[model samples]
Target chain A: MTRKRFVTLTLIPAIGLLATLALVSIAGAIWFSVMNRTLRSADYEFVGLHNFLRLLRDRRFFNALENSIIWEAITVIGTLTLAVLLAVLIFETVKKPLWRNLICFAFLVPVLLPRVAAAFIWRFLYSPSLGVINYLCGLVGIGPVEFLANPSLALISVAVVDIWQWGLFFTVILLKLLETLPREPIEAAKLDSARTWEIHAYVTLPMLKGPLISLTLVKAVESLRSFDLIFVMTGGGPGTATETLDLYAYQMGINMGGRISYASAMSVLLLIVTTMAFVIIWKAGKKWTN
Target chain B: MANITCKNIVKSYGAHPVIEGLNLEISDREFVVFLGPSGCGKSTMLRMIAGLEEVSAGHIAIGGTDVTDLPPGERGVAMVFQSYALYPHMTVADNITFGLRRQGNSRAEIAPRLKQVADLLGLTPFLERRPKNLSGGQQQRVAMARAMIKTPKVFLFDEPLSNLDAKLREKLRTEIRKIHMQLKTTTIFVTHDQLEAMTIADRIVLMRDGQIEQMGTPDEIFERPRSRFVADFIGTPAMNFVRAEIRAGDELCASGGGLTLTLSPHSFPDLVAGQKVELGLRPARMELCGQNSHNAIHGTVVLVENMGAEGQVITNVAGAEVSFVTKDFRSLSPGDPVTFSIAPDHIHVFDPETGRSLRKD
Candidate 1:
């Protein structure tokens, strides 16, 4: 056989499988939205753009979209910032290897636990009464505060749980990247009379830009589809304060209401949003890496 | 410029001792090269002097001030790492002026110093480019410029040219010497390459197994090595060692490998009859001679390595192999008869047991 035939034969199966899965799922979603379709209905009626029109008029859909944007912004920024700071502290500042390992392992415990379990654990911790958080607050003379029960604090509380569960992912990745950074530049910085903070600001942070951007992109994409933690913890309660796009889509199609066509439209919109986010982040990552 | 004094320095890792009870005084504006094999702790010694490594026990003083406990940043010294270590994110100009800026130098002061270093290192055009954008030699220039712009009391180089190619190493080696002459900073350079130490050093401190084997000027160290280790380490193809017994009579002589040599009266004055000694002859100092010459060792050529301007002729002297370099290479082939001669003044005698040179000089 010719080389080109052999190469084509070898690559066709893998590429075909992935392409088929992606095209079929996307095409099915678009088809269901364009046609009047329900989960239990036997009849399929063509209703062009009816579900999207209804989605445009839906206020709850806009609220969910806004909440999702807020959720992604908070979780991605908070996780990355806190992870970088903690990683630096554990890896650079803490010289003892034993202590570094112990601290890293402690942070990794939350990541190892399932997200639903983490949500439940945080739910108990954020309880107004009989929770350790309020007890600690009582010691500081602060009254019991409703964390998940209040509309203002509900989204933030859920975001905090997500941060707690997934922040270690960033920490582990960034820590590995930090370990591989060239030692000479840091030693040079030290000999150049840069103090600890100055070294981090000028040398360490600038060198970390590539990894930071890549990890930010990862975390942003991951948080966009976040559902399990919110589903377990808040359930979009307190007047939908913590309702995100993923949770609203699930609730519309499978939970409180059965609006599969409307849900398909929402999923298609989410797909577009995610694709745009990934493109923007990828461009930013390329610029920084260069 | 300032002198550096290391007194009874000791460095150990847990139970393993690296540098032990070492003492050396580097005069102001002196360029000293620490020459040794790998793991001799020469780099560690330089690091100790730069305050990058903590001295286990001893005092290191720069100029007249004791700086044993100070951090590297406070030690008033600059170092060029083997890897060059220019900040990849910063421009060449920023890398050169980073120390000055960190020390809170005004922009006016920093600009002139940066410009001076850039011009000196021929980095003026590439000042705006980052380290990754520059070539290896350009990055090395940035590293040197960074250290030079500081103008610290002492400069430390940890095998800075070992990473470069052979041609680049030679070029940079000469450039380093020129820079040293222009700045006259008390500099300590650590390298395992004896050639680098020989060409660039005002004084060569030869180290062996974490201790100072010998220290002297290049000529003194090369011509009058104090130990067998020094003689073997400081020369290419190394100095040849022949085990011989001293014959005492009206004139002293050493005989080994069926070859005999008469020793000068001033050489090994305390030698007794029938004492075992190792005789050292540098390959470059020994010369090819006609057969049956007086005071000559006869041998047959085993290998002739023609190195362009010079040739290394390895010959079998009795049962032992002896090699020498000669420029008069004309149709020399293996299995040909050859004779080599060494002057009495050029011979080095060492105690067989201790490897200590017995030659008084």
Candidate 2:
């Protein structure tokens, strides 16, 4: 085949995607202008950069922004720490490949489950009255405690569900990374009189830095976009305490009212934040690997 | 440095035997090599000695202590693997002093040990570099230095120089010999390369099919092999084998070939006249005896391999392919009928069926 034909075949998908993006951008610009016309010119208008000034005064927006940051922080640290710990433990302790594979399979079950289904499953388990957790706590003389029902505990509860459902994803990936590492150096370390803990600390841990950074980047972006699990578990309950940007956009655009333009604005903000996080992570990864 | 001994060592995987009831004794300060082909239990034997492989039915003693049940570290033997097995993440200094640090040695203790080993291996310049950043020979030195700094009872090398290029192999080969000489540490090196075994070993233990074929000094094994197998295994271009039979007139004749030579009847006086035998001649032993020379055979030269400084000439002798090496490269060419003879003392007679050398007691 000629080089031109090859180039056409490869570029066709990119061209198609760009065309769709251009058409969507055109329709969106027109719709945004129409929406801006109905509102007052001072508060919300097509006047360039006016809404950004109002956005600075928005309390709920700031609260959502703070919550998003806190959410990402907790998720990234929690997932990476737990995943690496679990992977290292299984790598050093598990001798049977079959048993290790089975454990990995069990971890992947949560990641494979539909997000809504997993959230609901966790919701039932955390239900205050007849939930197994409360019932078990009662055996230890503890009273019924609101997990997702309490406004103070709502975000934490949502994070717990996210960690439980997707922590396995990190565990499995990192576990494979650990298993594929050369065994000879570790053997040499053992011969070198390195204690079990020292082997993990000096040898295995340093080797795992690459995989850990990669998993952190992926799980951080994933946590920022997480919507289904939190929605099903808490519905931003009690005082919009667990109101993430994704839930806020859904609540405003679809559930509360047809504030499509407002939700779109929130979406553009989420997209920018996520894109910035990804670009930083990609750059860091490139620096590390290079 | 300490001596090591294996008593009735046996190892098997499931039902297949790898090391079958083997035994060996290594004296203190001796550089010993287990020379064999792949899958001949040489590495298995070394691993058992290092406590890396379980001895199925034997006891291992190091420095007069029974260590068959001990772990590798407690056995006080450090091993340099074929892959170097240097921790890629650690700098050269850290890799060398890892064992000392783990043994609860203070930085004061480890620092000097590291410095001494690094200096010994000429690795002081690369102390801060990681193993992956170093050349293969340097990495091998790092591995040796790591094992050395531990000051174990025995140093075990499992084909340590096999991964290097030919030039580096020779360079590291001499370096290893010099290190062994300086340290005077008891070492057991395992390799399939006969050249490495011959060049570096104080005593070479040749193994085949999970058994020791012969064990002796390099000179003894090379000049006087105990069996046809050892004769065939030790030399480069390998020893040539030609089947022969004792004829009615008590002459040695090349079997199925029209070649005849006088035999010293006293050499095999006990064997029947018609008994079959094999003659062993190293390539370097066979010389270009002149035409019409006594006990000489005329052979058509088949191929002339002119390596620098020497030549390996393959010839068709009495329908048998015989190879010989000569210092004079231009002395012979292919298709030339050349006469060659081997001295009676240079010739090894073997029982053709069992491949055992027939030594006169």
Clashes of each: 0, 0
lDDT of candidate 1 over A1-290, digit per residue (tens)? 99999999999999999999999999988988888777777788889988889999999999999999999999998998888787877676787778767777787899889888898888898888888998899999996989988999899989988788678767877777878889889988999989887888899889998778877887887887679888888899888999998899999888866778889989998898789878887987798688
lDDT, candidate 2, equals: 0.82
Check candidate 2 and list the clashing pairs: none
Cα TM-score per model: 0.95, 0.91
| Top lDDT hit | 1
Which 10 residues in a row give candidate 2 chain B its minimum summed lDDT? B250-259
All candidates: DockQ: 0.85, 0.70
TM-score of chain A of 2: 0.87
Candidate 2 per-residue C-alpha lDDT over B1-361 given as tens digits, one digit per residue, 9 for 90 to 100? 4888889888998898888888889999999999998999999898888877788898999999999998778889999999999888788888888888888899987888888888888999999998888999999999999999988879899999889999999998898899888889899999999989999999999999999999999999998788898999888889988777767753644343545555555564565667788878788887788887766867899999988888888999878888888886486778888888776667777888898877653
CA-lDDT, candidates in order: 0.89, 0.82
State which candidate has the highest TM-score.
1
